[model samples]
Target: MTSSQEQFVQKEIQKISLPSANTMRLLEINSNPEHCLQDVIDLVKLDSALTARTLRIVNSAAFCPLVPINSIDRAVSYLGEKMIVGIAVTESCGKILNQPLEGYESPAGDLWKHDLFTAFAAKEVARYAKNGMEADLAFTAGLLHDIGKPVLSKLLENASKTTIDALDHGEAKDYLAAEKLVSGVEHAEVGYQLAKYWQLPAPIAAAIRFHHNPSEAIEEFQPLVYAVHLGDIIAMMSGYSTGSDSLQYTLDSHYENFFTFSSNELTKIISDTETAFRPALESLAGKEEN
Candidate 1:
């Protein structure tokens, strides 16, 4: 990014609120392999708003529980750690994530759908991963991977065509490079800045920073990063893209080292991602509407 763009991004970052303390703690606990359901429940109980939101989602039409669930413990368990974490993030960052990106030509909610699908796809991809990766962590990482787009979208207004032209002329190898060339910034770096500002977990910050180029991530985080990378591509391939830049980025073949997916398994990942996406969308959308 140019000096001016960098300054603008930093200025804008200051205007955005950091994730809530409950949300930050929730992310940390979710990323811990040793954490149990009680940990999440305990944290949720500390924040009444989040607690109420959790219960609301559990009883929402998406779940359609035969009986209303009044207990925090049961609600957290039913929603799962991944869903709870998602709820927390939505509570904190929904406004930014749900904004329309006139720059990318994507409408409101497009980024949310894309990120949600990517989260599910990354979680599915993690099933085939080695190194004892956490699927829930991957889900969280994928959900926030494109956060920078909202920050940079206005700056990129009307620049999509130039970005595409750069790609065609080989001035840039992929959309990310073209983005930097056209606007002096790319979404990933802008996102990394936001992640750091929010004090998000290191792995998640790394995932946001290096998702488009997994190999650049440190060895410890490479597996998680690759899951998000592949998940991102799969999200776009499934047509949940954020517009103009869709499918314009390159796929890093190095992901093959971290995951092994048979053609059938890949198909199933896409199918499973779609299956999980619908109700989650309905639940969240219903929450927003209400």
Candidate 2:
């Protein structure tokens, strides 16, 4: 990104609200192993909406529990700590993420669907990566990877026609370059700033920053970055993607060598991602109904 774009991105970052205090507390509790299931239950009970959504998702068809989980305690015990935290973060950002991303040509809820799918894919990929990458962290990173698009969409509303046409026509080779050309900054960089402002973990922030270009990320974050990168690609391949730039991204050839999933393994990963994703989509849809 150019100096001017960097300045514009920083200014916009100031305008966006950070994640809620409850969300931050959940992140803290999940990050610390000392916190027990009761502690998470206590924190979640403080927010009625979080509790409701948690139980709703746990009992959704996607999970297919033998018995319906009615209480927060049962939900916590059934889904486990990591998934509870994931649900908290997702619900916290639902308001912002649920909007249409005009710049990316995504209709209402399209971006969120893509994000949710990527989150599931990332967690699955992390399990296969076996590179010390935590599934929860990977899920968080993938869920928020495209967060900057909403901000960019607002910025693009008043932008020049050339930039708008470029993105619309898919003229650029990739979305990142198109974003930089039009808005003076890319979505990944803006996402990085937003993550930092929200006080998210360093690795999560880094994964958002370099998800599209994993090679640029530092060595410490490479594994996590790779997980998100491949996850995003898998989401796109599985037909959940932002419009126009959906096919614009290039898959890193190195992933085949580094992650080394065989043909059958890759097929399983895709199938499992879809299976995990379906329930999440259904659960969220049910939430909308209520």
Candidate 3:
């Protein structure tokens, strides 16, 4: 994006410092299953709104709580270790989710809604990949994967509206291309910076950078990063206009080999995504945003 656009992203982001040191400490618990379930509740209790948001998610039907999950601790146990981290990050990325992206076709909160579906799709891919990587990290990474678009858009706020207009018409080659022509850095690079600044795990930051180019995935994070790449693509194919990436985005053949799907299965993913749409959007909306 143009230097002005880059400034816009930086200006908005600078408003919010990274989460408190305590929250960064919580981000670490994500790597360990043994600690994830217990520790997430402790982390969220520091922010009452997040605690309440997480509890509601755990009590939702996808989790099938035996009883209404009455507290963060119970909710954490019900969701188990993997889910706790996913829920926490989902809660953590609220600002990114709610923020505006001028160049994206999506309307207010629409991008965030699509991000939620992508997270769900990523979780499904991880489960089916059986890649030893935890699903929550994949989910959170997928959900916030394109967060830098907003940063870039804001950066371009006062510039001419043509770039944003092209994005609305779906004519931009990709966000990175448009962003580069308008601003110096692309969303991926900006997002990578934001993720690191937020103290997100390295794998997640890596995924953000490579979600559009899984072939570039570093050796340490390949399979999981690849899973998120496909997950976000599939999520967009299912018809949520969250990003410039779409069915048009290339899926790496090497990585596609990892997951098997028949036409029937493909149909089911679309069906599941459609079925979950309103509810998922409502879930995010109902939460008291941070």
Candidate 4:
């Protein structure tokens, strides 16, 4: 990619819509330990769509709450701040992520499914890895990791067939390289720019930017990035709502050298992720129904 083309891609990214203000406020509350429960309820109530989505997800068969949750306040109180924020993040991006991206052969809702699976997988991997990494952070990184894909999809919609062929043929070293060759910018780079624009934490932004190539991530953020990368690969390997880019990228050998997980450990992580993903998959089905 040339410098001029890179500049053009950056300019296009600036034009992409961001998460809603209500969701942004919810994220802020989630990050602050001092925030009270009432703060979450008040903000959530401001967005009826968010309120309904939250209630539906909380009341889903997966959660299996002992008692029914009819109100946003009660739901927030029951699920606590972290879970609520996570839900808010997913809900806020649902419309954008759920859209079909013909460029990537992702039908409506497929990318969202892949994202949720990856998020849960990342959380499980972090738990098994036990590297003092926060599961919620890992989950967030995984969920938002591929956000740039949709943006690129839009660009590819009108791209020349030659460019699309290049992407499909593995002409470059890897998927990112292929993307860069054809589009002048890779999804990870675009995702990072969007993350910064959204004012997300540095670590999360770094993870999104470097998930496909964790070794390139800054030393301080490498572990988190590696966790997300592993989670993404595991999700793809397990055939969890994979998209056109599913097998296009190569797995980094450094992941094995860095984490040093035995075969049994890897199998256990995949199994645990599948268990966790079931409820999420069910919830998505429920969403489609409504």
Candidate 5:
């Protein structure tokens, strides 16, 4: 990206609201390896709006509890950290995440569904990491990976077809390349800028920055970044794509250094992600409809 476009991304990022303090704290606590369920419960208890949302989701049709659970402790325990974080982050960032991206030809809610699907896929992929990885952290990183799209989408509004044409004629290698060619800024770089402004955890920031090109991430973060990368492609293949950009990025074979799942396992991962995504989508996005 040029200096002028970089300046524009920074300016647009400033207008985006930071996730609420409670949501930030919840993310921090959940990202920590030492954190337990009690930490999440305590944090959720401190935010009345979050607490109410938690209760409403837990009792919603998605979970189908034997009885309505009223206690915050039971609610948090039943939903688990992954779902809780999804609920909290959605409450804070739903507007931006759910916004229509006219530039991408993605209607309202497409980005949100894609991100949520990728999150579940990443979490499952993390489980097979050669070295131990936090599934929940992967889930969190995956959920926010595409956040820069909404900011850069406007710039692409008029250039979308031109960019796609470049891809068809091989004028640009892929969507990301076309994005830079057309708008002088790609969504990943824009998202990285926003991730820094939000003061998100380093792992997440790296995942957002390098998800499309995992090999470029720092050595320490490559595994987590690779998980999100694969998850992204899996989401697109499974039909949770964000409009025209779906399946447009290259997959790095270097991921073999971190994961050794067989072809069958990969298929299972995709299936499992689809199974998990629906309930999450309903729990996190369905409440508003009712």
Candidate 6:
């Protein structure tokens, strides 16, 4: 990003509103970092919408081959604690995602589909990395990664339409850069601010802020960001909208050099993951209709 782009991104970030840090703390407490599966389950049970959404998903067509996960615990046990964490967070995120964001040229619920696809793709990458970072976290992180775009777009109003149109036409290099070029700020900085406002876990927040350009990420999150970047690229190639935003990839040859997997390994991961989660994501998205 150029200096002007950097300045633009910073200037635009001032316009967005995000959830409070205290709320994020409450979310983290409910999520239970100590691995208390029961605490997470108990919390999920209280949020009626969340509980209904989760159960509906478990019993949906995606899980049809297996008998319905009769109750919350049954669903938890069936999906495992990590995946449950991922599911709960994604459900929480779904509320905002379903809203229409004209800034990105996204209609009513398109953002959720894009988010779900990225989350599923991120989960696949986490499964492959097997680096002890839970798959569910990766999934949630992916789903929320682009969250700043909507917030920024909402704040900028008509001013951002040109940027959104450019992204839709594949004319922009990177979403942030394009946003900066037009609105005077990038989405990553805006997202980071939003994450902080939401009190999201540091890792998740960092991942969202840096997923587009993993090369500059700190040590703890570099791999996860790498996975998300690759996942985003693959998703675009597979047919999700790359938009006019995020057209220019910040990857360097070194990123390829450092990637430990062979092309064949990545191919299999992408193919297998798409097949595994497409139905699940589609079913989850359809619940809004009922």
- For all candidates, what are the clash counts? 1, 0, 9, 0, 0, 13
Query: Per-residue lDDT of 1-290 in model 1, one digit per residue for the tens?
Result: 67888899999888888888889999999778798889999999999998988888999888878899999999999989889988888888999999999889899999999999999999999999865689999999999999899988878988878888899999999989998998898899999999999988899999999999999999989999999999999999999999899999999999989999898999999999999988898887765346
Give stretches of model 5 more than 4 Å off. Answer: none
By TM-score rank, best first, the candidates go 1, 5, 2, 4, 3, 6
Off by over 4 Å in 1: 287-290
Evaluated against the true structure, the overall lDDT of model 5 is 0.91
Cα shift from native, residue 87, model 1 (Å): 0.8
How many Å off is the CA of 35 in candidate 2? 7.0
Model 6's lDDT to the true fold? 0.64
Give the per-residue lDDT digits (tens) of candidate 2, residues 1-290.
56766677678778777777888887777545366779889998999888988887887766768988898988888877656766776667777788887766678888889988888898888877754556777787788888888877766664445564675687766667776787777778778778888888777788889998898888888888888999999999989987656767778776653476777988999999998777667766665344
Candidate 1 at 23: error in angstroms? 0.5
State every prediction's TM-score relative to the real structure.
0.97, 0.85, 0.78, 0.81, 0.96, 0.76
Which prediction has more favorable TM-score, 1 or 3? 1
| Candidate 2 pairs with clashing backbones | none
| lDDT tens readout by residue for model 5, 79-106 | 8889989998898999999999988999
Instruction: Write the residue-wise lDDT of candidate 3 on 154-205 in tens digits.
Output: 6555543555555567766665555566666777888887886676778778
Residue 135 accuracy (lDDT) in model 4: 68
List clashing residue pairs in candidate 5. none
Off by over 4 Å in 3: 1-9, 20-23, 32-36, 41-49, 56-66, 80-91, 156-175, 243-248, 273-280, 287-290
Model 3 whole-model lDDT (C-alpha atoms)? 0.66
Q: Which ranges of candidate 2 are over 4 A from the true structure?
A: 1-11, 30-42, 61-64, 130-132, 158-173, 256-258, 287-290
Q: Give all candidates' CA lDDT scores.
A: 0.91, 0.78, 0.66, 0.75, 0.91, 0.64
RMSD score of candidate 4 (Å): 3.6
Distance from true location, Cα of 289 in model 6, Å: 7.4
Instruction: Return the TM-score for candidate 6, rounded to 2 decimals.
Output: 0.76
RMSD of each: 1.3, 3.3, 4.2, 3.6, 1.4, 4.8
